[model samples]
Target: MSSASSARSGLRGRTVVVPLIPCPRCQATVRYYVSNTEDHEGWVFYRCPNHSATGCDFWFWEMEYVAYLVDAHFLVGNQAVDAVGATEERREELIRASYERRRIATQVATSRAALARPGSLQQNMSKHQESALIGLGAEILVLLKLLLGSVMLLCALCVLLLMKK
Candidate 1:
């Protein structure tokens, strides 16, 4: 499939779940990879295996892809579709939620880069201290995701209850 056509597909005609999405271009299962490039060190993403040889350019940020599937009712495994409704209003809410997540992730990445720079405040800290701080940041990010997921569940339940009444 052409890149533009696949770009418009958005997980259509395929089963999707976290960490197991198929590449829209080559139909191959994508694997998570850490970016080693100077521009986006430590960032994770999915890349098609055919990208190097066959010129398939299917690449997506890991966190953003998860947010997209979870928010947009695209996650079909584990009975997720029933939990997340596919409606106009729900679609709008999902867009907002996804955007907020991306924004927060960008902020965290910026903050981390600033702290890790040479001669910065973090440079004065011991290696253990710096590692601990990074660990803490990751833990906080997980906690935030849990909180957001819970809130989304509660909202879905409320909508269902109202419909039943």
Candidate 2:
């Protein structure tokens, strides 16, 4: 079978559940869903399910440390193995990318706010400045209306001449 077909078949028959643990830094329960299996050598990362603005920042291995960490919370009754699951370096890369995106968003917001301040020409025009702009806009609208009316009149005259012929 082709690699794609084999991958599809593998996914169709995989059953794996990785228990989640609370964040050691913030003590919030993290939720995680596995998209791949252990036989495939996949790593599962925990995510805090709290509100986006105030969520805990914790993630750890699903196989070994998760159960022990849960026992330490006193919710679970048993301690498990000490072996830590292999860490995925991609997790740190993803976190760094998220932070960079947030930094850029903050910078954009600050620049826009600075541009919208009172003295900036892009925002908060004086009453006289606003009136002048409104007057110019009205004059342009009147000219457009007259131009359209003239075009319609010329079209009507052309049609009348064609009918007369």
Candidate 3:
């Protein structure tokens, strides 16, 4: 078999197309390929479209790509795999969730910055300043609590889904 055919020997008619994720090197739609070699048989991975032609060596295991998606806010941590085959409504929901997460993160950063203002500690605190600081602290605590609760809930859901699987 030719090298390309040998490399894709593990793929069959049933292999589904992976969600589109651009190749970092070539700006092309990355292809999902399965490993046929003895050491990594059946392992699904993403790679640049035909390395010999593109001269792009972008490659990553499926799980690694999932993590990259999560970090880039393209997929939520809880829905990374499932989001691959998500429906239009589900994609919209994920987008909204991502937006909400980013909004909360921005709010937290702003509050933290306000609390760490320069010379706020070096000088004596006015009553108003003290109250503002107290308010900011309370807001931070609330945001943190919300974030924790969301994480716990996602964890529980993941456990339940795994059990089902």
For TM-score, the strongest prediction is: 3
For model 1, residues 38-74, the per-residue Cα lDDT tens digits are 4455455667878888989877665565555566555
Q: List where candidate 1 sits over 4 angstroms from the true fold.
A: 1-17, 71-165
Q: Lowest summed-lDDT stretch of 10 residues in model 3?
A: 1-10
Q: Model 2 scores what on Cα lDDT?
A: 0.51
**Candidate 1 TM-score, C-alpha based:** 0.34
Clashing pairs in 1: none
Q: Which residue segments of model 2 deviate by more than 4 Å?
A: 1-31, 34-88, 123-165
The weakest ten consecutive residues by lDDT in model 2 span: 1-10
Q: If both were scored by lDDT, which would come out higher, candidate 2 or candidate 3?
A: 3
| Better model by TM-score: candidate 1 vs candidate 2 | 1
For model 1, how big is the CA root-mean-square deviation?
A: 32.5
The better candidate by TM-score, 1 or 3, is 3
In model 2, state the lDDT of residue 91: 39
Clashes per model (N, Cα, C within 3 A): 0, 0, 0
